[model samples]
Structures are given as C-alpha cells and as structure tokens.
Target chain A: MDRIPILKIGAALLVTIQVDLHDSVAMALEEDLSNMIVKAGAKGVLIDISALEIVDSFIGRMLANIAGVARMLDADTVVVGMRPAVAITLVELGLSLPGVKTALNAERGMALIQRRVAESGLEADHAAGEF
Target chain B: MRIRQIVRAAALEAGLSLVDQTKIITAASELARNTLDHGGGGHASIERLQEGGRRGVRIVFEDTGPGIPDVDAALRPGFTTGRGMGLGLSGARQLSNEFSIATEVGRGTRVTIARWK
Candidate 1:
C-alpha cells in the first residue's frame, strides 16, 4: 500500500500524510508527524487533507496534538485543502482545533506562515525602535 | 467483503488522491468492522453531491445495536468500549469533512459523514 509521504520544502516542510484517518493509523500518523517536525528542524508544516472524507474525534484530537508538538518545536502548522463535506462533518462532530490555523489551499498556507515569520521579526525590530 | 470494497471504491471515487483514498478506505473499513463487531451489524450508504458547483461524497453508517449511553465520554480520544483501541468513531470523524451522529436508547445509532471532491 502507498503510505503517507513527507515532502520537504526549502526551510518549510510539507508532510503529505494520506492516511485513512481511521483508528490505528490515525494515532500512528499523529505520532509520526510529531516526531518528524522535531527531528527535521522545520520552520513550518503543512498538512494536506484534500483527500480525507471523514473526521472522527480521535483524529481531531490527534491533529490538534500534532500541531501542539510542532509549535513546541518552534514550527508552525497549517491544515490545507479540506473538502467542504469533511469540513461540515468535523464541525457537526464538534471536533475542532481552535487557534490552529487553516487555509483553503497549500499555497496560501505557506504564504501565511511566511507572513507570520516576517511579522514577528518586524514587531521585534519595532519594539527596539530599529528602522 | 462488499462493505470493504464499497468503502475503498467510495474513497477513490470521492476524488481523494491515491494516498488519501487509502487513508479514507482504511478508516471506513475499521468503522464498518466495528459496526459488525459491536453493533451486531449495520448498513452504510454512499452518495455524491454537488453544492454551489463544488462536488463531494457522503457516507452514512447506521446500526441497530445498543445505543451508546455516554456519547460524550465515548468520543474521548483513546477511550474504547470494546477490546480494540477506541479509535473507530473518533478516527472516522477526523478523516472526513463532516460527521454527525443521532441515536436513542434501544433504538439505533446513525452516523453521517461527507468528504468533498
């Protein structure tokens, strides 16, 4: 079977996980992504879920957990390209990761991350009154 | 066998990339198995929908087994009522775009999910 693949971009890492988002695999994938972010020293992570059809509670929590771990590693996480039905299911199920950012597409997600990085730097410079 | 095949086929037909289709299939298989194992048996249906020019697929799994008494607790991550890892409901909810559940004591449980193409 073709399992999920981790795609690395320049500085920004994209983990293209295409898992059934089911039971055991869901848990395992969450752990795997968490470890990968820490080990890779990636500055940003994008989760492309354009393929998923369902979103259960365990999967929701796991995604949130992965995001938490990535943040601890100083890598931002963005979920991208979810189908509308899948989005509705997640909301109906009451499974959500509040505060975790998401984008309609991967490109936008990457751009958002870049902007965050730039904004943080600009804010620090301004605090020091640096031009 | 039919359920498994249906799940797999539906995942692919739903426009999930090959890798994502597999993930969705896996999730559906596990959930279908649980329906048989825990619910004693159930029926699932799949269909395609187009809303506002966007396409997607929806799957509904319904069972007449003993209704879950504490749905809130049952949905907790890592909590299982069966011997298996309690990831079925939770996992399925994660892999799709929408998930909804309706059930009553001694009646039945109905789960609806959709994944857009």
Candidate 2:
C-alpha cells in the first residue's frame, strides 16, 4: 500500500506529499495526519505540497479537511509550496480553502507555523494538554 | 488513471507555467473521474496544438452513460446529480481558456477544454 511518510521534527510534524495521491490515499492521509498530530503531541504541522502536480477540487477539499482537523487537535497547519496555477485553479474551483493557512515554501511555512503557534499560545497548551 | 498521467505529461511538455500545468491536470482529474463514476467508464484524449500562432493544449473526455438531462443546470456551480461538491464542471471551465460540452439524452457526453499559452 502507498503511504505518505510523516516526519517528527522537534515540536512539529512535517508531511511532504511527493506523489500523485489517489483519492483513497488522500483520505488515508487525512486520517493518518489527525492521528499523528495527537500521538506526537505536535504543536505545529507543516505540509509541503510543492511536488504535487494537481490540486483539483477533491485535493483542495482534502487540504481544507486536514487544516480543520489539525486545528481541532490544537495543531497549527501551514500548507506550503503551492504553485500559482494551483492557487488560481483552486479559486476557480470555488474553493477559497477557508480556515487553511498557506506559505510560499517549506522554510516560510515552517516559520509561519511557528509564529502562529507562538501567537496563539499553542505551545503552552501543549504542556497543559496533549496537543 | 492512465488518462490523468497522459494529461499531466502533455501539460508539462507544453512548457506551461507550473501553476497552469497543475490547473489542467486538476481539470483532467475531475473530468476523468466524472467519466468513470458517472459515465460508467470511458476514454479521454489530449492534443497539443498551435492555433493562430498561440500554443495550447486540449483535452477531450467522452463517456457513453445516461447522458446529462439538463446541461444548463449542470454548468452552474453547485448543481450535481451525483454526490459531489458540484464544482467539477464549473471549475474546469474556470481553469481553461475555452470550454464546451455536448450530450444526448440517449447517447453520451463529450467535454472539450483548452488552455492557451
């Protein structure tokens, strides 16, 4: 079975989607990510999708779903490396990806996630509870 | 599956912007899925073309299933006969430079879309 690897980097969980994901794979990712965030007690999540060739509405929805679940689990998600064409296409697809945060690249995304975590007092909550 | 791969390769080979390549590939994915789930499985074709000195790519998807009974409604966003967000058709049109669809009630459906460089 094809599986997207999840790497634990200090206080954050980084997921680099490097393959063309089947719909089933995408769903599996959503479930896996949600579980990882809780098990790892991660404060931030950085999803690198620069290698993705497509962000069709389905994929677009999956991204939003991840962001939503991550937030509920007390993890900040910063999606990075979105190609401009994918951005334009997503809007055209009527998906503004509300509630999802985005960054230009992995570095920027990591920084953004950290900054968001700091601003929202996420780190303190991590000690107070399993985030 | 194979159709999406072909479309992705063709879109990239056209030297389109990374974003544009993604857009076409996304559109291809949605349309191809529609062909399979709704059209009961079919075939799709792609063409790299140069018309009026402008280079572009075209993707055509055909399926012989229960054709759409109301195309006008289907073209509108959020109108789906199947379980979907109803953004596939409308979203594809938004991503392409040109979009057209033809279907017969008892026959099949054909959708063509092209993006220029």
Candidate 3:
C-alpha cells in the first residue's frame, strides 16, 4: 500500500496529498496522521490538496473526518491550497468541511497554525496530554 | 475516479469555465462510482457536443446489473443501499446543468449528464 508522508516541522506536521486517493489509502492516511500527532506532540497539521483534481463527497467527508479527529487529539488541522475547481465541486457535493480551517497555501497555513498555537498557550500544557 | 479526470478534461476542452469544469467532473465521478459499486463494475463514454447553438460535454455511464428499483428514492440525499451517505446521486444532479437517469430493474442502468459552456 502507498503511504502519504507526514513531515514534522517544528511543532507541526505537513502533508501533501498528490495522489488520487483510493478509499483504503485515505483511511490509512487519517490513521497515520492521528498516530503521528501523538508521537510528535504536534500542535498543528497542514494538508495541501492542490494537486488533487477532484473533491467528491467521499473525499470531502474524509477531510472533515481528519479535522474532527485532529481537534480531539489537541491539534489544529489546516487544509491548504484548495484549487478553485475543487472548491466549486465540494460546495455542490453538499460538504463545506465546516470545522476544517483553510489557507491559500503552505506558508499561510503555517502562519495560521503558529498563531493559533500561540493564542492557545505554549507547548508544556498540551504536550503533557500526549498519548 | 479516472473517468472524473477525463470528463473534467473534456469539459475544459469544450471551453467551459473553471467552475463548470469542476461541476461536470464531480457529477461524472458520483455516477461512475455508482455504476461500479452498485452495477458490479462497468464502462463509461464521454463526448464533446455542439447542439442547438450551444457547446457542452456529455458523459454516459452504463452497467448491466440489478438496476435501480426506484430512481426517485435513489435521488434523495442520505438514501443508500450501501453504507454510504447517499449524496452521490442527489449531489451529482445538483452539480450539473443537465442530468438524466434511466434504469430497468434486473436489466441495466444508464446515467447521462451534460453541462453547457
């Protein structure tokens, strides 16, 4: 099975989704990301979806799922680089991914994550809850 | 769905705007998945069109299987025979300019959708 790489940067994790994900692959990614956050004591996750050509209802649900789980794990997930085409499709598919924050690109996403973490408080408070 | 990608390309080649390109491609994806999942795998066809002084793209997904018993029920959101959210049929319909479905129980199913440029 192909695995999407999760790169840990400082207190954050960055993932670039460049494949047309099969259902199992997407499920694996969600699991992998959850485990990585606990092990790394990460505060943020930045997922880039610009390379994906389409965002169906299934894929839309997957994004929301990742965000939902990440929040429960005490991490902020920012889905970044959504192309104009994907944005239009997702809306029509009846999914807005309400809980997932988004950014124009990776740089801005990183900034958003950093700002969020800063406002929430420093590392020790959240790190102690790590799994 | 590979057909989704192809249909999107065809819609683009037909000179539809960026938004329409995505919308048509998304519709094709939902229908193609239905053909494969419910119809036990099938094929699809896509074509560029110029009809009635308008340009657009059309895609047809066909499968020979236990066809839909009631299309009306299938078109309702959150209705599914499987463990899915059942947004494919209804969401796809909402995304296209033109959508049509034909199915005969125990024979086959065919869904055709188009979007004008």
Candidate 4:
C-alpha cells in the first residue's frame, strides 16, 4: 500500500500529493488524515494537488469526505494547487467539492489555514504551551 | 490510473487541447472505476479517430459483471447502487463530446465516449 506523506507544519498538517492516486490509495489518505488530525491536534489540513493531472469523481468525493471528517474533528481542510485544466475539468465532471476550500498554491493555502485558525480563536501558543 | 494515463496519451496523440485531454482522461477514470466496482471488473481501450480532417479520441469500457437494470435511472445524477457519489456515469457523459451505453440485465455493459479536437 502506498502512502502519501503528511507533514505537520505549525498548527496544520500539509499533504503534497505528487502522484496519480489509485482508488485504494486515496481512501487510505482520507483515513490517515483523519487519524493524524486527532493525534496531532491539528487545527487545519492543507492538501497540495499541483502535481496531479486530474481530479475524477472518485478523488473529488475523497476530498469532500476528508473535509467533512476534519470538520467533525474540529479541523479545517484547504486544497491547493489545482491546475487550470484540472479545475476546468472538475466543474465539467459535476464536482464542485462544495465544502472544500481551495487556493492557487501551497503558500496561499497555508496562509488561508493560518487565518482560519486565528479567527477560530484557538491560540496556537496555548496548544503548544500545554505540551 | 493506468487507464487514465493511456487515455491522456491517446488524447494527446489525437491532438486534443490541454483542457480536452483532462476532460477525456477524467471521464475515462470515472467509467473505468464504474466497470470495476459496479461491473465486477472490466477492460478499457483507447481509439484514435479521424474523419474529414477531424481528429478525435474515443475510449471504450466493457464489463461482464451484473449489468445495470435501469440505465436511464443510472444516468441520472446522484443515482447509485454502489458506494459511490453517483456521478460517474452522468459526469463521464458530461465531459465527452459523444457518449453511448449498451447493457443487458444479466449480460454486461459497454460505455463508449469520444472527444474531438
């Protein structure tokens, strides 16, 4: 089973997807991200899909599920780096990914997560201070 | 994923635009997964088409599993008999320039889609 790496950056977890994911791999990623959110007490989740060439309905559903799960666990998810063609195709494929937030790139995605975390009033220092 | 790669290569070989390549590849992925999950596994093939100086790419997915009983209902968005988003068949239809499906109750199902450059 192949696993996509998830790096804990600041108060969020960053996932840079650099491969075309198989169905099983995408499911695994969703499960792993859920566990990581609870384990790391993550405030946000950022998935970078700039390297991916397509976002099929399966992958689109996976993204929506991840966001739903993260929200239930008190975390936010932001998907970043969708190629122009992929974005156009996604809409045509009838997948708007209703609940998933997206940004143009990873840098901006991280900033969006940080802002959300800040607005949520979850003090990063306090969370770190307790540990 | 391999199916998608083959579709992408075929689309490019047929001179599809970047967005068109993505469209066909994505549509192929959706249909291929449907064959595996709902049809109990199948095969996909890519076809390069040419007619009157027009070039295009066509993909065919065939499965021998339990065929869809209600294709009209299945083609409706948000209709699913499996654990999917119910967008595979309809979404694939939307992403392609030409689409067709042939199926029987217990026989099998064949879906073909084409995109012209």
Model 4 per-residue lDDT tens digits across residues A54-113? 888888888899999999998888999999999999888778897899999889987887
Structure candidate 4, residue pairs in collision: none
* DockQ metric for all predictions: 0.11, 0.71, 0.71, 0.84
TM-score of chain B of each: 0.87, 0.94, 0.94, 0.97
Better of 1 and 4 by lDDT: 4
Q: Which stretches in model 4 have alpha-carbon errors above 4 Å? A: A124-131
lDDT of 2 at B84: 68
> Model 1, range B1-117, lDDT digits (tens) per residue?
466567657666656664455455545655676678777899988776678867666778889998788888766756787655566777677666787888777877888877776
The worst-scoring run of ten residues by lDDT in candidate 4 chain B lies at: B1-10
- How much lDDT does each candidate structure score? 0.68, 0.81, 0.86, 0.89
DockQ of 3: 0.71
Q: Which stretches of candidate 3 lie above 4 Å from their native place?
A: A124-131
Q: Residues B18-97, candidate 2, lDDT per residue (tens digit)?
A: 67777787888889878887899887889997768777789999999888999989889888887667788888888888
Docking class of 1: incorrect
DockQ of candidate 4 against the true complex: 0.84
Best by lDDT: 4
Better of 1 and 3 by DockQ: 3
Model 3 lDDT per residue over A1-131, tens place: 99889998767899999988888999999999999999988889999998987788777778888999999999998999999878877877887786899999999998898787778777555544442
